[model samples]
Target: MAKLFTPYKLKNMELKNRVVMPPMCQYSVDTKDGMPNDWHQVHYISRAVGGTGLIIVEMTAVHPDGRITDQDTGIWDDRFIPAYRQMVDAVHSYGTKIGIQLGHAGRKAEDANPPVAPSAVRYDGEGYKEPRALTTAEVEEMIEAYAEGARRAVEAGFDTVEIHGAHGYLIHQFHSPLVNQREDEYGQDLPLFGERVVQAVRKVVPADMPVIMRVSAREYVDGGYDVDYITEVCRRYRDAGADIMHVSSGGEGPVGAGGMPVGPGYQVEMAAQLKRALDMPVIAVGILDEYEDAEQVLENDQADLVAIGRAMLRDPYWAVHAAKALQAEADVPVQYARGYRH
Candidate 1:
């Protein structure tokens, strides 16, 4: 049997396989309320029925303006808990553990009247607003918001929680040299904000459940940090409380050759490097949709898990298909057993 179908565990969150459905925002919220609707339910629950080991819910906002667009989900208030509880319970019924990625969009918030970031540096992208810099006090408030979001997640019955510290969001802005030009604590210590977020999240979550943190190993933008630098930064986050590093790349600015390769497994080396450097389990993502390619990652010891994004969007039963192809135990629900029978 391939390791892709083998059960894996992290702290208290045990999985039926090594497949992970990384958070990809649906932007399907009908109202500006940040609640998960029927669209979210069918989208996620179908994947569970299809046999994904661990499903990380899309990057949900910790504050209102934290969302990239008004269509994204948010957990800034308690009223949102019941809706998430429904989603979480539905996903669990099929034996898949679910977690939510809590994040803040910072300067990239498309709907924010004027977004905020560590520095006044506007994303400078088309249609983006010039964001005001967050006050030091507001930054602290933001950290607490993350903690509160986790608290609500627990009440909603999430099996685990992920901190969205990658892809040039608020935590990323605080750490990226170009995005963060402040002279204060966060700037002086690039990983401080992320660490504080980890610590705060740890405070609310159960001591047994592992915390997953998604990080960009290297930036595609010129002058942005590299894998080597990000590894050290991640070391700080690990010490703070993050147990797994979901390694991805770029989003801070425009794409330029930052020396990272492109193509299948292009991001695996970065994940491998961080796994070696940080001594923490890592999830390798980007273009690893092919069954063999995804299996090769684990076989090669590059990453503890592989995330299938676009491919899974096309077919919810991607994990089941991979199992059949690999001749491993396919987690086909009994209702659909006839479809997968040889």
Candidate 2:
């Protein structure tokens, strides 16, 4: 059997396969209000139907002002519950577990509100503006926002809730020395923000619900947090209550160039590093499409779970295809069995 198709258990959650749909922002929510519309339902349901083990809903903003785009989904209000509930139900029908990635974009937040970060540093390049520094009280409120969002995620029937701590997002800004220059408790201190967010999330999320922390293992930029810094953060998050660490990299600044690298498992070394440092399961995601690559990641003990992003988007049935290519006899959904049998 392909390791990617093998069942794995994390805490109380058991995944049918290692194939996961990583969070990809759609920016498709209605302009009038941030709500999950039919586009989201169809977009996600198609993947679930394609037989992925875990499908993470996009990076939903924890607060109205935390969105990266005007059309990003929001969990701050109760109005979003029904839409999310329906989505969860739709995905569940395929026997696939679904997770929601909760985030606060912070300085990366776009739209009319501009953005806010640990410091007033502006993101490099166009469309970027100087972000207002978040005050101590505001930081406390942001922590509460994450907790509240976790509560709503549980109420909405998600199997897991992942905190978006990577990709130079809110929590990441606090971790990166390049953007965080404050002498205050939350600034010069690298792990304070992540530690606090993890603690707050633990308070609201149910004990049974798995909490995953998505982190960029390397900033890919000089003077940004490196593997050692990430290891410390992951250790702290695990201690605070993180069940898994989803490892991905880049996003230090425009110089880092998020998706410029084009190679298979380019960021797998980061996952390998974290897995060696922490006892908790580590998830590896980045340019992972081939079955051989996925198998090696597990066989070499680089990661416990393998997450696919653009590859899955291109072929929703990539998991089934991979199983066939690897000569693993996994069941395909009845609707697509004809193609597989042929």
Which number leads on TM-score? 1
lDDT of 1 by residue, 1-342 (tens): 899999899998999999999999999999888988999999999999999999999999999999999999999999999999999999999999999999999999999988999998889689998899888899999999999999999999999899998999999888898888888888898889999999999999999989999999888888888888898889999999999999999888888764546788888999999999888899999998899999999999999999999899999999999999998989899999998656
The candidate that wins on lDDT is 1
User: How does each model score on lDDT?
Assistant: 0.93, 0.86
**Per-candidate clash tally:** 0, 0
Cα lDDT of model 2 by residue, 70-174, tens digit: 899999987888899999999999888999999988878877365888999987757877899989889888988899988898899999999999998988988
TM-score of 1: 0.98
> TM-score for each prediction?
0.98, 0.96
Q: Cα RMSDs of all predictions? A: 1.0, 1.8
